[model samples]
Target: MTTGVTGRLGGIARHARPRGPIETLAEVSVSVESGLASDFRGAVKPGGRGRRQVSLIEAGDWAAAMAETGHSLPWWHRRANLLVEGLDLPKTPGTRLRIGQVVLEITQECDPCSRMEEVAEGLKAALTPDWRGGALARVIAGGVIAVGDTIEIIEG
Candidate 1:
């Protein structure tokens, strides 16, 4: 039923390692082995198999959360890897999406953490409902993705 649905890529960001400064980029390289090469989350640790390879959030959801929290923090403050627009991010896990040449599967929600409140009061609560915190995904196929790239749900 989701066939043909599409969205636009709005932004991309990554951190070198845990709790490191986040850097926004115009484009990024993604792979099945490593989610985003520049992102520390991509590194496959001994037990980390890359299931949470990438993180994504919808612009609409972010705006709504900001409105509710009375804060206008940058999308990256949510600490997701990609910002998307237009497409409805599935609430159910296992949804697959294609961005440029990269294929990603939604593994779970990017659950809001105490880190959110550390950024702004009530932010965690604002991002709590309706998948607002974003989606966590694993790279199924490697490809280069740039800002403004088209994103689509891939139906099997």
Candidate 2:
């Protein structure tokens, strides 16, 4: 599967590169719901939310600055299954994405917290005064996602 953006969405292609070979496939998970800061509690499930999805700005138009930093830890440093390329998700909230069989709706932009600054070097300077970085998405549908799965914009 060609897992990246295509056409006008082709912007994602700019950041994609081959991952080479792997021994086994990885399982992908998404948070059913998410919120910013204090609101995050409400978004979590009874047990707990799973891995958060993220589109690393480094893979997209922001790569220049991100590369210079030599760090994936931006103000919003979170582990995401898919490191999206060529997409600034926080800037464009409400965007819909399809990854494998899962459909995700961008709910709101994820703001950075002091914790991110401590975890990632130079992150404090990378964030805005508000410390915003990327968008938080709600899983509209659930399914398995692999490294090569296509990420398409179903809606803007």
Highest TM-score, which number? 1
Residues 1-156 of candidate 1 have per-residue lDDT tens digits of 476789999999999988999999999999888789779887666777677889999999999999998999899998899999998887777788999999988888888999999999999999998788999998888989999999998853
**How big is the positional error of residue 36 in model 1, measured in Å on the Cα after superposition?**
0.7
After aligning candidate 1 to the native by TM-score, how far in Å is the CA of 49 from where it should be?
Answer: 3.6
What TM-scores do the predictions have? 0.95, 0.56
What are the runs in model 1 whose C-alpha is more than 4 Å off? none
lDDT of 2: 0.45
Q: Which ten residues in a row have the lowest lDDT in candidate 2?
A: 8-17
lDDT of each: 0.89, 0.45
| Model 1 clash number | 0
lDDT of 1 at 94: 75
Q: Model 2: residues >4 Å from true position, as ranges?
A: 1-25, 29-43, 46-58, 61-77, 88-90, 129-132
lDDT of 2 by residue, 73-143 (tens): 33223322235554444345566778667777666655545654555665545543331345556666765
Poorest lDDT segment (10 consecutive residues) of candidate 1: 42-51
